[model samples]
Target: MRSGAPIPDFGEAQLRAVLDAIPARVALIDRGGRCRYANRELAEFVGLTPETALGRTVTEMLGEAAGVLLAGQGGRALDGETVRWAGWLPFHNRAERRYVQRILLPHRGADGTVDGYFIFSRDLTELVESERRLLETGAQLRGSEALSSAIVASALDAVVVMDEAGLVMEWNPAAERTFGYARHSAIGRPVAELIVPPMMRRRHVDGMRRYMETGIGTVIGHRVEVEATRADGSIFPCELAITEARLPGRRLFTAHLRDLTEQRAAAAEIEGQRTRLHHVEKLSAMGSLLAGVAHELNNPLAILLAQATLLRDQATTPELRRRAERIHAAAERSGRIVKSFLAIARQEAPRRTLVRLAAVVDAAVELTAYGARSAGIAVDVTHDPDLPPVQGDGDLLGQVVANLLVNAQQALQDRPEPRRISVWTRRAGEGAVVVVADNGGGVPADLKSRIFEPYFTTKPAGAGTGIGLAICRSIVGAHGGRVELEDVPDGGARFLVWLPCEAAVEPAEAATPDRADESLAVLVVDDEPDVAESLAEILEIQGHRVTVRESGQAALAAARRTRFDIVFADLRMPGMDGIALRRTLMAEQPQVGARTVLVTGDTVLGASTARARRDGALVLEKPFTPSDVRTALEQALMKRDPPAS
Candidate 1:
């Protein structure tokens, strides 16, 4: 290009083309505040041709005030600073006025001094309107969070906040009361260290760490029931919820906790009362059962004993001796009845063991077989070969089966057709079932519903106590099983008992004692001379020195004086019962109190028995045999110091 000639440089044309291609309006203003050059977009934006815009000062085109505004902006641009302004500006051709943004950028000469200004203006009316809407939206969001916070604080449940570090960040008023800590005291403390029980603290910390790392949670977003400790060092139950929250730079957790102390206590109280009511009902039924059992065993025993004595006096032949043997067998059966009653009423804890269902069924059948045969009833038993062993008390289960069989036989006595009592045992899914069915006149539909209810017997006043079925139900329930009655298709009623089966357990071998000729002094205390003398006789037979006292006070006095190796005292004696006497003795000589055994006929003293057991005293029910007395005495004596001479 020539130095000062007007050259058609392709580079300048390309720049012009690029500027004209821009969507935004573009213009050029000289240092004197005159519009020197305008691009096509700017010309169209102002509704003027580029030739008309050229060499026009702002005052000549728009007026004096507009001219001064433009001149000031040009001066700012000439000072080498970009000037930007945006507002509403009127267009000559556009019907409606609109908002626009004007950017003024200074252009420099070859000497690095500002020569002119390049201005670009964009119509940003839509963008400014959108920004206004966004500002309103932000205000709404802030109001929503405030409202939510207020609602959560007003909730009845205790609210707490913790940061990702598991430190308490906020504690509400409800939380203070629930945790027995003030808000000021709880804030900034490690949440797990403060609220979690010692045993669960480490687990809670680990869970928090895991959740933070993998976004995996066990309790988050879910409500859970757990144990909580209060500031008083007392533990209580609680329901809790944890939720995750996002913060600007970290994560947080909000916990809602509800105290379940009162709920749990009320539930426990109701359960205790229910158990007590059940026990009371059981005792009432037992009273009726005692009456029935006594009635059933007494007549047979009197006949057998009387006949045996008569035959002993009048026998003259082998046939008479055979009859006497029959009398003896009958008496033995009566004795077994008494034993069963004693076992049912015994205070001893259940001895749990694995017992074969078949063995228990066979034994029970044998017990009632003679009576059923005598009543002209045919007995049938069917056992599944695949039946599994059950964990239970063998004697108690045998009693249950015996009771069921006896009830069945009694039901069929007046039946006209073939009287049949069938007992079936089979393996059920995941359990075993024992069914006792009778083909007698089926239970009256009305009576079937009440058969298992305590004291609701269908038999004539003296024949049944109505407790057998109830006891069977209780026994089955205690084993975590069920007892139900099903209707037989043809006739009669079926009682099905389902019990969980367990692997067979081998019986523990009896331990042999070392031979030692150590003699122990034993004290026997009872109000009844017969009972005291019986116990004394048994103790003496066991090679122990024995003394008898008729009252608890007397027993206490004797214990203080003699230092006996063991004291077997009747629990219900007059003037200081076993508990009071034991307490007095314990206060005086704990050693003697520890060696004491409580003997009573009343098996229904629930809390009294519980307290005695808690205090380490052995309880024995009455009507015990000589061997029973001997074993109890030996065990108690072995637990005490040697008796002084």
Candidate 2:
């Protein structure tokens, strides 16, 4: 215990017991690298007893590989220096390697000189393995953090992390781009103040507070759509999802945000297209029904119109004439209504003709004036006498005018009384301009751009089809014209229709010039008995020898013997219709065929009718008056013997 003091000298038994109890392999080696003394533990480690291990060299006790490491340390100790070496060594008794720490201290004689050294080796395998595992775990954690940071940086949606107090803790690159803020400016700022819209900021703060206090979140773990504000104060629709992360006593929230502006626009466009498609399907079905109706009703209506006209012309007295005239007038009105329905059906292609703009406006006004008056809205119409005619379909142009008037009337439904609509036509440049103005609320600013779009409407649901303006634009466009809304200064709105003017051409007047007071042999062919009888009577009254046939077969039989000056045939018959009858007659006698006239009640022509017309066979649409009948006869005469041109 004291320096330079050797007190009691224990026997070898006491020394061996002390060395064995130390739990370390202890040995003494002389300067020649051979073991001089060994404790019980050191001797057992090399598979030898204490007496057998004595006087063994380092290489013989451990292994050649183990001795090489210890030889250097022992040589250094012999040179009067204490040496420490720690490494893996395989001892003679163990098959596996052991991590050992060896300390070699020099033991010198009483004189200041180097001597043999003592060796102390302890096992440190478990401690070294634990330290190595700790280092591996640290590397794994760092790698995981790096991967998370890279994903957040490259994510398409905005990634934002906020602390418990709602201050932004992490602002990824996507967040900076989405919120219009740089990372430096966003971090440490209240996230709600940065991206939450002004109207939603209070709600966001309250939600965060509630979650922090009660641990309940309304938006957490769920995706929601909300309005978000940009740095420039613009608000946009944003899809957001939030997640809560709790560490120890602190809470953090991560939000993922995606802008929904384009997505919402696309969805709205698809809906509009769907509505338009549905409307088009309905219109197509309605057109088919109207076409069928026209075919069925025109036959009876034609008989009524022709009979009334003939009876009026052949009336005996004043009273009979008046009654016949009234019947004829009623039939004419019915015919007009049918024509209007045909126009609405849109079953026929537009027929281009020199249309008087003034007449079209007046007719449209008269057609809709009753509805306007019933709604307590006064109507005013004026047309310029000097306005030129436009080459377009008269019925279609009238429809366009009527649609404008009806739309104006509907616009005035919710307005106060004393409402009025005014229509005016004038000559502008080389075109005719018709302006329809109404004293009602004008179109909204936001709806102006989409008003012409199919299925877009401002009228209350079920009250409007939403295709009125779209149809108007289409008709006008087809006619090489344009319709537009002209802003009214005071109130209401003005709709202007501008159509290019065309030189007017008068309808040809058909007259029997060669036989002024003479009648020709005429044959009338019709499937209906009344129709054929009425037409025959009309022809007979004109001093013509008329023959009535109920079917094309009957007409063909009669026409074989008689060289009829003209043949009148109904187009749509039960058997051997007009086209077939005409073809057979032309094969036999080209003159009679050339003078043939085909009549029908159908407004929509078939391909056969079209072919007949192309062959120069005159066709008169049904519901014909006495004048129409005369025109057909004269046209057939002109075709049979064209004037010597």
Candidate 3:
């Protein structure tokens, strides 16, 4: 009961009292499994006094089942082995069940021989139940942590956790992918040094310090866009969201970030498309305005030319004749101006014809000359007589040429006083090339590749529509040609337009006999009285019976009353326009519709005219000479009634 202790010279009675007061049941057994000694707790648990229990064996004192288990453990101790065991078993003579733990130790004699064993047993039901509950709580906590880890691992945005010292504590899989850093490398590293750009590192560290000290954070609980550096030392845009969590004696920062490189590119693409659409709408509006202006100017020009021609033919004196001829020349120049407007406004499929490239250049120069002069830019022109003609749409080709010239002029607008543009045409292999070069700051090397892209421009904001070169390229491409930026050593931009050429076929001679035969009834319809009267006079002088109507309704009524041999109806007019009038005539009187020659001063109506032509109807553009008028009449008549073979 007592080891090497002589506290107050304790006697055997006092030692037994101490042993009996202890919580554990204590006993001593001999090698035969017979009790040699027992504590008060042990003796009371077996319903026996200590003296009586000392003479009994373990099986006789406890019971068959528990004594059999205890005997084996006691045997090991007796054989010089220490033993321990725990289980739920009956005690107090099998009255109740309780969990108990026991330790058995070998008792040695003075000769070092194991002759007995010592047993120390304790009832541990309360402690065991408490431990079982604690284990369940621990398992639940581990399951919760596993669920959180799974969530972080599967997230699309990067999830990063940093301690109060700004060192990384956790880096999820998304974080590894986003920052190009492995989890092993990122943990325990300073977060700022790992992902923050060099220029922003100091600010990031300062912000963390301020937040930790004052509990006030600028970016915490907010999402923001910032530049982040990758592991390879490259910077890119990133969207970041931070949340502050206060744990026991420490603060943690959780950051969610997403790379924005692709998103930003998509946004930029959308913005560019929006800009191109806006410019297209503006060009369409400009086309509409030009059409209106052409319509207005063609009426007066037609009247002037008609009157001048009659005056010149009837003049008796040379002075009067010269004046009339001069008037006619002025009207012709005005007619060219109107034609330029039509060329720009007309947007339709190409109409192929044998076109002289030099003539296209001349028309473009004429249209851009005044603007070039006002901008203090000099334009020089050159042409090679050997330049072969190309087959293409003249109006579209002229538009392409004009766009290049205007681009050159605008390019040289901010240049020095000697700003100059050189334009020339030459015959290349099976093609003709027109070169437009400007002596100004050239296009940047980086932009040359994308120069022809819609809405891609080198001009400052609001200075250029960015579609000119794109349109030019499209037109040239449609014509089986190509436009390219020719590198010039002189440090200015040069654009070359090369068009495919076909073998030239000489036009057969046309004999015009000064005679008018087979006179027919003709109707001229126009919104402008002058235009209608002038057209009527032209038809009358050509020996045709002419009728004039200032409105389409009047023209339609007159056509219904009398079967006119031919009808010339203006495309745009009040009430019913030429297109509607023609439709009615075609339904009511197919002959008159077939003999119709639709007239339009608005070349913007080119698309409509093109449709009319496809339906086997003839069309005449306004501001025409007597020759053009006669040609239109002949074509209409020829279409209405073919000559016998």
Candidate 4:
């Protein structure tokens, strides 16, 4: 039928012919469900001619159920409401189904009395089945969409979808957790601005634009590790895998991202462990070599000192006495140098001490200034006197300062006049900041990053080892601090060391002068015969009865026999190591074990250091002198009850 149109005239023959030839299932029924008129299509559906169908009631021609249903609809039209519904009508063959879309309208009499109904019916079997199939397909598609959404919601790795314009379209639950952004805020926002750091946002935007224009992308279809800024503005590392999809006239990108912060931390830890392992290995090799060298040199050194001492005390000639004094002084100085070498060889993991920055900086400056001023470099020091102390290894921090000072001095040496080094410490945030700047040419921007990397140096062969800055970084890192190079406005290089500040100062212990007076029996243990006897004789001169043992097994035998008041054991010896010997003594004779002195040039760290501290035994480094031996005995004596004195 036509839209917004009334029923056409049915009184004319031409109009009646039009209705009969309409190819629709058209019919007109009376108030009694009797057919008044039937089109060619309707007549065929009834298996009767239009003239014969007019006298039959619908309930008689069709079945009783369908006829009653039709009668109710026709009754509504009789009362002035247009009724439209899709219902099945029986075909001529009862076994066949006939579906039709029907409309019923009221036809009023000229006298205003209710008249019969006018029914217009249409056969929609083909259209109805097609819609049924369409509805089923739609349900399936809806289910698939729901499943994809669930998968995205439950994904452990973040999934993000953005449009060709780089605006976020869909952000899954994982994305929300990953970037700390709500889905509502993330969607419809520019992706580059949302998660990309400001420094990289321009590049991200340009790259996206270029890829959209040229169909070539660097990030698309590639998994890359990138720095992503979170909603809180904190940046972290993330691994991103992106794939591009083109739909009709639109393009979209889907990314799978995983946070790499923990992975990066674990990797750094592994690398640090590897470096420490290497350090230990090198320390071990050097320890053995130095121990042997110290042993060989100590025998002659002991002889020289003993002979010089004898001459100085008993000489009648004043000139001979003065000569012996010089010889004695030389031997003592050499002994100090050997002990310093042992300290280097057996470098222990630094024990943390609460110390002020000024003291540490002053100590380093005292050591660095002489050489610095010798090169005509003026040194200036500035400090914020109120700065708090930090919990760290003072010696290690001093080493860091030494490295920076050495680097600054070397830089100044090659520069023109007006060479100067400025060192200062100040409070910055929750940290103590130290800056060492020099009036030498500033470091190149390109080289600044590699300066702290191990084995990376610009100096000529033998002029410098590449490990200075690397060691500085390691030491600072161990203290939970940071060291970085910054640009100086004065056209100089400035290195900043940042150490975390402790909230409250840990009080320093009161110092007591050494009171190592009470001396008892002492044992000297070593694999070298001359080294052991020389150390014993030196102790014997200090008024302690001394015994010499050339091995850990021999030392253990001596301790078992005499419960010595003091035991000096070499770390590396035949049959048993110093650690094993000490353990056996500690288990059998706890009193003698309490006074054991273990000396080493080896890398005695970790478990060894822990055990040494636990046992309260002294571990003096090797390349010791007569004095180091006496000092050990005195400390052990202080720990004891002074031998009933």
Candidate 5:
């Protein structure tokens, strides 16, 4: 045989070379379904040589089923049609062992007649098994993504997703509910414009842009509270949390929002209630102060009147005149005390003006001198000559200073040593300062801190109203100042009040001298006989015709009988109060009612002074001077026709 020629290839060398060269197993079959030729691999698989396998029917070598399948495929090829089949075939050498396979390409003659089939079979079991596993894994990944999306959709807090450019990518159902916008409307809109408040819209847009450009965030990755505008044109507060993430080539942000409107409203309501309670406590404190002031006034008035009556019965002498002058002074001091108490309890509109601090202190000291003398306390005054004036209600500040003097005197009443109260005025930085110091046992350590608190007092129950210092503090505070208690190194308590002073000097009001009073009939009504008598005497001395009635009912009856120019009636009389009497008189005799002047020593009457004024009547606070009484009587008389004889 030639070197490259086809060998008469029953030789093992040629067979082995052909088998190795073929990519697949190649076998040849005989007419009886027996193996006539086999490649090296096929022969090895069957555990037989080509010579041993030749002319051996497949049914004799392997199984009947294997033989039948081989014969059927070969017969189809022989009919001049290319045939291919794949199935499980039994191995000749292995008993009852099968291999899965596929066969390819049959051989046919050029005359269009089949000669025999050339078969190539391959094992494909592992490839089919690998494909099954891949399909299962793909299904599981899809299921996980679906479950995650479902969870996000069902959340209660508003969830919004945005692209790097701040355009809304996804808006969940919760977002729709919170922002009052439908998911469809929000999905394609810019998130900043849709959800951010108008005031914050520009900032939000800039922040998002900066974060996208430079990864510097103003709000991203942080939770914050902000106001959001809703579709209804109302604004609601909300808490927002933003988180940034990357998906593919795009950056995304997710925001979670929670509404805080109800919470904020609840907090504001609670604060309002607390403020109301504080006012109620303040009023209760005022009630106590009123009682203390009434008691303080009554004590001096009783003594002064008793002394005056005794002096009136004595023989005329310089000493007697001096004693009578002292009594009159005491009575005047008591009158001032009542007036100050009425002013504090009354919620009168402030009459603000620039006032001298030194003058106020001096007036307070003079007014409380009699009481301080009675209490055996000496008052010393220290004033800064160059102290600046303060803008405030002069009467109220004077009342504050008076209250401090009285308190200081009372605190030192029982001390064994000579008790001394000092009134000091000075300029402190840009403000005016008034200091009232007393050489009392000093404020108790436990009570010092609470001295300015309303309703807090060291005096026994029913003695002090606890509101004096509180009112003082409030008045000073209203003038843009502060009141505080400090330790007096000389073993006493010092109360210092600082008030902001006017930067420039103000011109003083021109003083007007009092004119001689024209005689006018005045009716004085009071439950206390002495109060009525004292008022009648004061009015009579002022050159006014005066008549005294002990009750509101008597005043009304007296007004009906006599055409008096003015009816001065006490407010808290029994049977009929001053308000009721005025209404009755108005209904019965309109002219007389119009001239009705309501007067009361009770501080409570201050509360209704405005209403009384609105009703076209003059209101005179009790414990007034003869001058005040004369002025009110003149005003009332001027409004009325002269009394008919």
Candidate 6:
């Protein structure tokens, strides 16, 4: 194992070249761990030449730190075991670190006893740093994936991922809550079947197919408001946005679904408020016009009746007297029609009571049957004698019934001589059902759906207001009922009103007796001259002495001058509103304020604002009738003086 340590590969010169070309440090060590030889690069790296490095200890060549690290392995190799190890090593000349990967194999003698060892070592700092960076990159990627998964799972909007086939692949917790489907149930399930309504299922499938084929979906990448069915088979509005993903290996689509049910409901409520406000404005104007006409007509009718009575009393012949009576009768009938028009046009708050359904239908028929017969249409009426009463406003219900009858009459106007209208009542699942059928030209098939929608009508613009059926729907809905229209079996339109049956509860007589019939001094205040005068007239008829004032200030001044038994004040007035008037009265004359009744054309005054409910003052909506006024006065009087209680 001297300088002539025979090299194995091709020849001594070639072996030296191979050893020099090699990147690792090569050395020959004996049992003493001395370098019998060293590669040129290793010699040069350690600032030693081959001639200077021959037959030297590795500890003297490399330095103390590297020497200590390799000494044990060198000993192990000389003991006939191969040694391999890796570790950090410090530069011999500079304050820096390097990693070394080393291997030691024993060289054998002719008798197979260990002679010395050949050692190999390479710097692994760059490779190790590369691997470290790779590991750090992997950890960062995993962390990013985890954060993304957490975000997707915790997203408020339902995150649903589907494959090319539209089967749900990822169903997050939000998706589960939104669609009422658990992940286990939803995974691998068709999203269409799970959440699409049956009617839209075909469209959904076709859209997906189209997208798959053309690489475009009409709804893809677009946010759309659509109705989605839930697990419970209930439908609601949702905003859905779908995005395509070109991830590795497979194509997928992700859908973000946000439940817009509450938002839509709120929007619908706003629309409803606007519609109601419009209706109120329209009705208020109509009511005023009708009221004025009715007032003017009533004065003439009263004069005609008075004159007719006088003429009848002084007539010399029976024919003349009968002619006078006929004129009187015609005038009264026209006045009644005017009154009915006024009643229907006014937006009176419903007075729910155990209304006799049979009586209402009978009265509606009586009012409209003659007109139908005159129009050459036969009328038929059927009723279930045992049909129970329903809880609703009698006048409003009557109006609803009348509207049906009138509509039926109008439908029959253009029909042949054999046209007939059928009205019937029956029981339906703990409910009372009233059906008005007309054998005239039935409603057009396309118009059936829109008939109940507000402002939708088939009649000429001048003939139809377009809100009759809408009003019917509103009124029936208010009474816990539904109005359904169906085509009659024999070719006609049948309108059915289904109202929940309620047993008539005989109203208990109020413990407070009627003090309204008794004489009482009352104040009537309204900015409208007609309203004040009409109210005073109605009060005078009820045996109450009334004083009329056109302003809240005047009313208040009048109240202070005289302690009125009951004060009726219009809510909206020029000088002061009824609310202000009441506050002042409460502070100045609390007794009179207690007896005050507020009349308002604004329906919201008593309900919408905190002030209204807080005030809690007795309120009567305007366009009120004589009875509404009398009833309000009676209630005020009764409150002022309870009988024997």
Clashes of 5: 0
Task: Name model 3 segments beyond 4 Å from true.
Answer: 1-157, 165-167, 171-237, 243-251, 311-327, 504-522, 540-545, 551-567, 572-594, 605-608, 637-645
Q: What is the C-alpha lDDT of each candidate?
A: 0.71, 0.79, 0.79, 0.72, 0.69, 0.74
Q: Candidate 2 at residue 226, lDDT? A: 86
Query: Where is the poorest 10-residue window by lDDT in model 5?
Result: 1-10
Name model 1 segments beyond 4 Å from true: 1-374, 378-389, 392-403, 424-430, 441-478, 483-494, 504-517, 605-610, 637-645
The residue-by-residue lDDT of candidate 6 on 1-645, one tens digit each, is 544443332234645665676666878787767777787978887888976887677778878888887787877887899887767888676478887767787876534678788777767576445434433543467435454455567666788878988898778898889889998999999999999999999999998899888887778876567999989999999877686766556776778787877655543543444354445556667767765565445434434544454465567898998997787566556655555554565445677888878878876786676798789888888989888888888778888999999998898898887988888888888999999998877888888889998667789746776779999999999999999998766788899999998965777876644565788999988887766776676677667888999898888788888988888887767769888888898788777777788875444212322254357677765445555666777677665432232
lDDT of 4 at 133: 41
Runs in model 6 deviating more than 4 A are: 1-353, 359-386, 392-403, 426-429, 441-491, 512-517, 527-543, 599-630, 640-645
TM-score per candidate, in order? 0.42, 0.65, 0.65, 0.43, 0.42, 0.42
TM-score of 6: 0.42
Local error of candidate 1 at residue 589 (angstroms): 3.3
lDDT by residue for model 4 over 1-645, one digit each (tens)?
222222333223544555665545666666666676676777777687866776677776667766878878888888888787766676444786877767676654434444666666766565444334433443456535465566566666787878888898778998999899999988899988888999998899889889878988887865577999999999999978676655556766777787878656644543444344445456567666775576556546655665556567667998988987898777776655554343334456787878789977876776677689899999899999889999987777887887799899998888899899999999999999989999898888899889998667888865765778999998899999989999888698999999999997576853432544545677778886765776677776677788888888878888878858788887667689777887787778766776778876543322564566566668765455566666777666556432321
Winner of 2 and 5 under lDDT: 2
Report the number of the highest-TM-score candidate: 3
**What C-alpha lDDT does candidate 4 achieve relative to the native structure?**
0.72
Tens digits of lDDT, candidate 2, 1-645: 222222113234544555566656888787677776787788877889877876678899888888888877887898888787667887666788888867777765434465577787767665445334433443456435455566567666788878888898778898888889999999899998999988888898898888878979878976577899999999999877686655556666778787877656644543444354555666677777876787677778888998888889889999999999999998987776665666565445678988898888877887687789899999988889888789999888899999999999999988998899999999999898999999899987788888898667888767887888999999999998899998888889899998999865677865556853477999999988888888888788888999888899989999988889899999888889998998898888888888889988665635666677777778988778778888788777777543332
- Give candidate 1's error at residue 367 in angstroms: 8.1
Model 5, C-alpha of 563: deviation from truth (Å): 3.3
Residue lDDT tens for model 1, 334-421: 6555555545555567878888999889878877888898988888899999787999987788878988888888888888768888
